[model samples]
Target chain A: MTDETIRDVLTRRGLSRRAFLQVCASVTAALALSPAEAADMTKRLETAERPTVIYLSYQECTGCLESLTRSFSPGIASLIFNDISLAYNDTLQAAAGQAAETAKDTAMKNAWGKYVLVVDGSVPLAQNGAYCAVAGRSAVSDLKRAAGGAAAVVAVGTCAAFGGLPYAAPNPTGAVPVSEIVRDRPVINISGCPPIAEVITGVILYYTTFGVPALDHLHRPMNFYGNTIHDRCYRRPFYDRGMFAKTFDDEGARQGWCLFELGCKGPITHNACPTTKWNGGTSYPIESGHPCLGCSEPGFWDKGGFYKALSTPTGHWSRTGVVSGAVAAGVAAGLSTAAVARARQGRAQKKAASADSEPKNPTS
Target chain B: MPLSRGVIPIRPVTAGAPAGGALADAILAEIASALHEYLDTRQNHVIDLTGMPLSREDRQRIDAYLGQGEVSMDIHALVHSHIEETAYAGVWRVRHYDMGGGVHSERIEIIDVPEIVRASSADMAHSARRIEALRAEEGA
Candidate 1:
């Protein structure tokens, strides 16, 4: 492996250290880290040994990788390429067949127990794990083996984190997520249909510089996936004001009203797509007149129709039932609290009356 | 009616602010410097809108981008003021009132803590004196 410093790499790539440092600062801000941490991250990026990253692809369409390559910012692209030693990427690497396998083997051996393993697709468990294979080995086996030698595993798309479409109803391949397969190592899921390019790079930068970032319950980085898309959406004011588009071509739609009635899944989806944006902060789906499909959430495919409003109850749970249940719970809580208070009051009164009647020792 | 069709009608372009959010983009780019400064130094920046050549539409666009937040205050000082905190913390919209109760000066102020809400030194001194008087009267 080449031992070139990040500064040396940037210099070779015709990028200034100042510009790269600025990019680092921005990435830190994007990760919601404090300015002090941003300064710390800048130093880490500048001086740290560029860690080796082995990217594994399984049952996926390669859109996740494409999103990274199609990133509009040259500074971001250079930052990613120069900051890490991406050893094995089947799509981008020049080696093929036996040579490719050999290169991956060499890279793994060289950076064993320290390299970051990035998986982009789900692993199929059916048919003895034969659905998706690399180098004649199943994804499950490959992931397990690589995870054992990895410092951490980053599941980079919805497919790898959740089963995604592959594990939707009538799942033929019996696909399972990387987290489910690799139980030993810490897995950081960056879920999206094809996650925003900045998010992908941001996660990598944060992990490499600051170790594992604060993760939410779903093991996703809290800074990126902490808030629902609705919380950070620019169109959220319309949602709050009860203005929604009923149809695609309606006046409300043209006026850029909320798409809740038109089946925006922003309320359920947790990702930085709304704030961080896609295609180099150009716009997200909701900004482009389309509703969010809730791509980041687990079992999104099985969550009924994409165009059906989230308020429209499905399965055994009706909207009325949910409301009634909440109301009943509230009433029950109030009744219980009142009863407890009355009981306590009764006990206190009884004690006071007894003391007055039996224990009046006057002037002794 | 077998005919060789040569003419095809294309949809007419809608005359508006264009497809992309150009105005929003430009405004955000303008505020980018302020944001960077705030992030870097935790300092406050105040931009007086009255000094700028912004139309009502431009102001509305800026408001939409800023979004309504938790805080909105109406102050009845010498000049009545309406202050609103934007969705993003450290960003605020403040407007000074005129004699006729219309907006005299409007500004988008970015700061760690807005100075408008804080008590002035003179006010604090007066408050201290009042407290001392109250304590004396109460035989403290």
Candidate 2:
């Protein structure tokens, strides 16, 4: 609450100066900046002010917050997210009811026009925004008031970034992403079913260090989302060698071949899961013997079967078979891959229907 | 059980890019270029090894190529770190390990010494003050 620098807080809070440098080095490397920037960043961050952050949840599972906070494998670098966060989320904060509401209001008022607004989940506009309410107030109104004085809006998950699962076909609640409402303030979308932990931290650290980062057309930070899973995939050589895994238990599957034939959307999806990885760089989905679900991309829940390959028909490879995701969006119209997508989608629909029909009441 | 697709008899690669050597060669080439740029411009470069798709064989090739230098040290902080200078003078390898002993972030730097090794000015000042207080208490 005082006018102390970030380093002062870190030191006073028992985080060593060297540990702070380590964090700076890790983030600098993650940003793909020169190694020298580590020292420069270390110096700058020592004097940099810790910005106030306010987290707002609209319509989401707490998975995005779970991703940000590391319970499985806690590391000092990830803990930096907590050091600067003046977060007022009901889930993590102790206060509730009027006390919690008062704290959030007071914090926002004091840090108004200066706090970083981090929002997750989509905001439903249907039913007069009655689908989701906090303290008897609609999520839409809460979001509008909070965003009114925010320095910047950080959309954490696909729900907040691109109206995730709730915004799928039929969209019962008429869910709209944060960018749709907070258009006045600059919105940084970190879209994922739950984005990579480091990517979220990396984006925030980059913002605190050097204003807003360079964004792609999706308004996502270009540094982390620049390369697709297909681009940096370790199985890429297998793909280029024309060795494809047809099923989950095929010989090629045992041989660590490309899973493009098994419905991998890596060809058209952009994310840093391949690089930053999960569970602390242990392994990603593709490496763990599963095709990419493209969970980070928009409309991922509505996308076809997770096991359908993203390639053309058998025998020969076409131009559309191996196009980069950046260009794949425009080229999807005439591609034969679309047919496979539709067929797999039908199979997926059937599977969902059968599952839904299963007895919900075990006694019945 | 009825199989989906015809199980094509997979054969050894008798065609395109050489297996195992391609990625290692690419990394080696990157290091070589980075080393040259460092020598010529006195600029430092870092290649994030963990981010790359390096197999066991690729790792062996890179390890054998770089070898090991005389200077190697372990740093303990929030995360344990092992840093080793490669046989090449200006090239160094940095491995940051999580508390769980899994490799978190690994990279190669073409610098005099990795920045993480250096003591920060704040720490140095603290050290000086602490020692000064100790000496004064002893009436030296």
Candidate 3:
């Protein structure tokens, strides 16, 4: 692909060519595409028209927005605003009051069924959606309005995708996800407390490029959320060996043993954190000595404590009438020793036996 | 004595902080300590441990200890039976006993280990080494 087109776009947006190429490379790596595919992607990106995006905020903290902003290395916010035309975002819009509301209306009217709608945070439905209101309109009302003519709805963060903290226990606001309110269009759930920056950008890129990437049953992008963090965790070897961290700063933790015992949700949580990581793919929570909270999975908030170990059966040795704890330990020790002795004796015996079994030489 | 099975060597702790000295010296010391521990705690009363390498002797001893009645050495079989009995539903109980006269039973449940850790130990070790290298680079 000619760098001129990309460079032109970057120059117009006041972003460096290096930044634009970096975004392409990041997208390629995020999608797990080959180098050739990445080059092709760069070409496509250069030629493709920037998709229209409308971001909606509902009943929750702006943490998701903050996290999205924190996406380092060609930063997702920069890509979205500069590469793609972000039509309406209540949080970041320059206009305010009636003007701000008019901008959203104008964009929706203009784009009409050709825009991608991104919803962050959950919509409160309790009390006829009275819990959260914006500009004399309920959050639900606004969401329904925005989602009516959208090509696709992307539910960003756990709040928008799966209720998040707003939907947690005693959910006074009666908050619900975007999918619950808007049922007409296809909904892509990028679930996470505050999803990985690359994952968020990757989803957007996939949609922009191929038009709606493959999704799991949970409506998550299969590419980024298909595998469990435990599967790719660095401490996995310790798990296999039955070595575990009993406490946060104990010997096992210092040794980088599996955090299964200390309530790591990695075993059950599925995400690209271990591979895609955070801080520009620098390191994930697990590598930073924190257990996975399984933010990407649905109903994670309702699930038991974040620190609880995934329930694993103690194995057959603990069951049946074979041996008790002390007895088993003793037997294991004995059997191991016996097996070793037998192996050596067998080797020596084989040598002697072979010598005896050899046919006599004609000369002898 | 019957044929001896070669010992499955215990890997030295590789991820911990330096064991009170130079990295190389600490690693060597850790390996030696692991070997010593393997030798001391591995002996089992029931096994005939003659005519085997020291490592093999240690392994056999440990295996014998595990196979004994006290610890319910057949944990895998027990877990299987429990699953079969429970029809893979509800809580399954496994009994445990302390060195004292006290005894207790605990329920265990099924968990999904990420596919990443499902690889062979050798593969996991290699991945761990790579992770360590990455950490070292970052530290540097």
Candidate 4:
């Protein structure tokens, strides 16, 4: 079947055992697995057959492909791409026209019930699915056909996952996500304008290693898309201190203050951008002096002016006010508990002394 | 009494943050929380440090911050390791060695009791049976 294990591939490439283990550890950590699971993951990846992945593109800008290919440090291409058998990708595959379709079909037929169907971009279904086509066939038709025999369907970007930019208002083509088309199969969404390169590879590696990872309410991997960007942002301390950058060129901006006032959607956006960063732990949008556009979240394009702060009631308290109120309440509770404990200690000591001083009874 | 060994230079443990100390601090804070979890509910946590891109100097800096505790144990199993409890109780540092005696993997493990020190139940049972058999043979 020409299936090669990860260890065999690594050894053929002259990669050290340590390097292989490191990749295993990285993927394990990305999946939020315990350290013990890393060793198990390494063993699994060592002997496990590489799964066949059929990547289908619809109405995307190819930014996700760029992110996956152009990512710098940790070298995701070498780490992840070398391990998987990418059966079909229009952008990457050498085959053209009928040959490409034949290749995809051949792979699909060979890996039936085991292959992974990864869809990028949105599928248009406005006029009998006429907006996009592959091999003169509608995108919806192709997606349904591809997803039918696949083991799992992975929505690669915001486009395929949530109908992305094309699915925005005034829908002319009536773009719909892959999930809408593939109703029977489980769709794992890795959503982002152009999702983090490592994250994309991480999710793929996780599925290839573990059966199906634990996902969030949004059908995104919990480990990567679990926490809000604001919760993990380094500038969160500045936000809590109520120190915000009023303008892009303001003094606060120079001092690396919070971007909440400048319309940062970090509080509402869930992503690993703050921690994972982009370009191999270099920096993310907030660190590069830009307010988060909340790209990863659904309907981000319609989330009222990127420069406008989130609207709130006039009397609504700020985050600082809530923090201060909680602090005060905690201090009052602490003092009351301390006072009660001290009183109890005093009474116990008094009783002990009183008993000690009492006359002793003689025993025969 | 004459000094038997040469004077060993003691490096001063500085209180101020060093370069890349913030990253280490973040990791330490995570380990601290894991320690709290262990103490509160007796849940064990194993934090793999092998995946992180930590330089030798960065590791030394983190080690300096962790300091040392009274208890340290060296284990020589299929893979050799040096396990130590950090200054903070229930927080541990476990370093596994490769065949070449170099560190293969390092982890920050949090548990109520270190796993390496605990004997396996199966081994304990086997030893109990062996001792009883020996006593029976000796008629004692």
RMSD of each: 19.9, 11.6, 25.0, 17.7
DockQ of each: 0.02, 0.34, 0.02, 0.06
The 10-residue segment with the lowest total lDDT in model 4 chain A: A355-364
> TM-score for each prediction?
0.65, 0.82, 0.60, 0.67
The residue pairs that clash in candidate 1, if any, are none
Model 4 lDDT tens row, A175-225: 988877887867899999999877877777666766555565567776677
Q: How do the residues A246-355 of candidate 2 rate in per-residue lDDT, one tens digit apiece?
A: 88886788778888888888866778887778877778898799988888777765554566555443232222222244225523531233344335444544553465
CA error at residue B119 for candidate 1, angstroms: 43
TM-score of chain B taken alone, candidate 4: 0.75
Please report the candidate that would top DockQ against the real structure.
2
Model 4, A341: alpha-carbon shift in Å? Answer: 36
lDDT of 1 by residue, A1-364 (tens): 4565555565565544433543553465456554345556777677665667889899999999998877765344535653455888989987899999998889888878887899999999999999998889988888888888888899999999887779877789999889899888779999999887777777877767667665655677766776667766667667757878899998778878888788777766778877667765557899899999889877776656788876566453312342234223323442332344335434544543454343211111
lDDT at A226 for candidate 2? 63
> Model 1 Cα displacement at A187 (Å)?
0.4
Question: In CAPRI terms, where does candidate 2 land?
Answer: acceptable
Candidate with the larger TM-score of 3 and 4: 4
If both were scored by TM-score, which would come out higher, candidate 1 or candidate 3?
Answer: 1
TM-score of 3: 0.60
